[model samples]
Target: MKATLPRWADLALIPAINLLLAFFFAGLVVLFIGEDPIRAVRILITGSLGSSYGIGFTLYYATTFVFTGLAVAIAFHASLFNIGGEGQAALGGIGVTLVCLTLDHTHWLLTLPLAILGAGLFGAAWAFVPGYLQAKRGSHVVITTIMFNFIASALVVYLLVNVLKVPGSMAPESRNFAAGAHLPFVHEMLAAVGIKVSRTPMNLTSLLALLAAFLTWALIWRTRLGYELRAFGFSEPAAVYAGIDPVRITIVVMLISGAMSGMMALNVVMGYQHRLVLDYVGGAGFVGIAVALMGRSHPVGVVLAAILFGILYQGGAELAFEMPSISREMIVVIQALVILFTGALENLTRVPVERMFARLGGGG
Candidate 1:
């Protein structure tokens, strides 16, 4: 029987069902560990959303995920899997570092925009080579981007150890950025308006993340270029028949994807760490693929998915601390299960739903 679903059902309901199954299995894991799964759920919620401090950290993480998720989504629309978000984000940090080091003595108003431009430009440049190879040289983007991540890691390590390391410091990291380059913490920003939030790594960069999401929606759904990109994604031959240049579209989409991925560095490096540090990307890039999948590559869906992951991260930390039996390794298992069900096993639930819908339609 032919089976179909409304767009909203496909986007929202299928993912929701998959998520529930993931959590149910997660609860089973908790049960096997001799812990009350219900209590664990309670702790998870209370730990992530129960207090201002909790909420602050959650939002902080969600902010970064928003950038990386949107990055993946942008490329997915163009039929590209830009897995080098880690490297692109790291290069973006290099851009931020360069601008901050050169313009540190200036006012924040002067430094912030330049740093953003640097981050975006560096990120776009990093992706351009791969995009060009894919378009012009017939090189596979996946392999090249993955290789770039390792290269980026080695390059950053060399820079930190040999060039940017602070004098007499044992750590392999750059000096703390200047006060002018420091981003205001979310609590501080809130306090300025006579409201108060708990101290956390959350910062003004979250605003940038939100703005990126809105702009991504606009660029994807409300513009002619977006239509061309989607058309190219749907069928390159059809796009070519309609007079769109495949090479140009491919390169442009990757550039935009890289820039969005690079923006994640603004929060991690400039807003929180206040310095160039090793491993700053912290696997947020890889997590973004799952986010984009679960979100159906839509901006609003991406935001919600990001926030869900924020809950998982913050709540998982709390679970690890409160229930010592639930080690970090177990937390990783829980996260892996979520990723598995949502990504690799997504069709497991989808086929059943489709069959159910078919049966319903046939009966009618």
Candidate 2:
């Protein structure tokens, strides 16, 4: 006789297991801090879902995570680790800001698409540099992309503080975007229909984020180029023998991944901040790697995982306010634990106690 689990069951198990482990770890932290873990958990849950404002914030944050997670997932499918999503996103934001600032258009219909296109192009260009280096010179993308991240951060800081500084403000951010360029929240539009809700930052960018995820799924599963990219990922030499050009695939895949990453800025520029700012990406690109890992590089999984993180991010901040002893940074610990459990799930079965139990139960 054989025992089998459905594919959806396996998928469900990952998050269930991850949450169980997270709770266990969070309990330990609560004990160390002399607080009630159950109370803390209750606060986190209730606070995050208690009001319209919380839900709005969660969706707003989710918008960025979805975009960046898809970007990382795309690169992961192609066997590329795009650590420079932070840089690419920042550069894209800068491009969009510059375009909006200079275009001086009265119509949002014209400016919005141009800004998005400009941002995507900027991100693609930034990613292509590392892709070119990796394909042509055999340089390690990990090192080059990390360096690019630092450069991008520094460059954005300089540009915002000095070069693009607004006329009268002392803040480290660009001038507010033109009113026409700002994205209106869905809640506001719905309010016009007599449905009242808290005006959260959720916007059209969220729709774009979902569209990008769908496009990524289609690109990976339905396209000839995607087939070649996956082949190169599995084995470059094998792909070469099959007449696939690894260099071209690498560059194209990276460019596409980077363009997706660049879209992350849509939330900040058009939806939230309405302009570029220092640390606008909010370390989202780095967190995107964890999202990809949690999602196992699947498009739908990435979207789900990104939403989970978004919930934690918005909820954790609220939790800090409700429970003074527990800092908002606790979310980071939860995220790290999720990553650890997913990465080492197989190793957990090898633990001596677990192995002994498995043997006794005939479950191994």
Candidate 3:
């Protein structure tokens, strides 16, 4: 008989244990560098969660990750490896830029939805070609998507430098967006209610991210289409045998994934930066892959995983600043260890856990 675990244990306990192992090894690395690992951890927690400023920044970063994580998770449900989130997000920025620039004089309520629609459509368009290639030509989605990321970077650079650069501006960026296009900062919102928060990028987009997570959860687990997608992921042959069209499903899945990836632009570009700049994505696209893996492609898990990474980001900055001995590269190393443990090495801990549970009257 195949070993199994209860849903909660499989989803929560396993990932938690793996995460602890990652952090334990990360602490050892700090010790190897002659630094007190405990102090480093203390600094990390204090830096990320000790102040309202830190919490605001952490949530801002988490908001972006939520969108990208959902993008990855949606594709994963259909057994599609969408490595093109970077490209899709970049293109989404372009879409947002176009919408904001055109509606610079309009009310934010009108501009925001239009910008969102543009971003989603543009992102979906970017992913459609790769989806087509995969479904029709037998091309590998992973390879195609990765290649598209490079193409996206190049395309954005070209557009910014040659077509979209603001007149008389030296930098490769557009003109500042109009006030009507601005998303209200979280600090301002809180202040309106007599609650003080540090000025940070957290905004309405953060709420949108939360809403997206809930909607994703509903779409994935409570819908018939979600069932089909999951069935396809489990076995394409089985899906086909049940009369589901693989080509159609592949296309639909990629479109949805691309739209989610593109939506990240709203938080970073429209909500925070208020202008289009080169390379604004800053690797959040790839980070979403790690988030999805750690979260097991579930929306709730993705949000929690994204928050953890946000803590790492905010805390890592503190670690680098406070202890010059621990370089920023060390932070990357720590993140990699987390990814390695939770993703590629997950089965190492999971198998043993499953066995232990099996012996304890738990079915696996």
Ranking by lDDT: 3, 1, 2
Please give, for residues 1-364, the per-residue lDDT of candidate 1 as tens digits.
7587767778888889988888899899999989999998898899999999999999999999999999999999989999999999999999999888888877678888998999999888889889999999999999999998899899999999999999899999999888888888989988999998789999989999999999999999999999999999999999999999999999999999998888888899889998999999999988888889889999999999999999999988999899988887887777788789888998898788888888888323
Predict model 3's lDDT versus the native.
0.93
Candidate 2 ranges with C-alpha deviation above 4 Å: 1-6, 344-364
> Top model by TM-score, which number?
3
lDDT of 3 by residue, 102-186 (tens): 9978888989999999999999999999999999999999999999999999999999999999878889998899988898899
TM-scores of the models, in the order given: 0.97, 0.91, 0.98
- Give the worst 10-residue stretch by lDDT in candidate 3: 1-10
Cα lDDT tens digits, model 2, 91-135, are: 889888887787635656777788889889988988999999999
Please give me the total number of clashing residue pairs in predicted model 3.
Answer: 2
Error of 3 at 276 (Å): 0.9
Which of the two candidates, 1 or 2, achieves a greater lDDT against the reference? 1
- Each model's lDDT comes to 0.90, 0.81, 0.93
**Whole-model alpha-carbon lDDT for candidate 1:** 0.90
Q: What is the lDDT of residue 264 in candidate 2?
A: 86
Ten-residue region with minimum lDDT total, candidate 2? 1-10
Where does candidate 1 stray beyond 4 Å? 362-364
Error of 1 at 20 (Å): 0.9
Give the root-mean-square deviation of each candidate in angstroms: 1.5, 3.2, 1.1
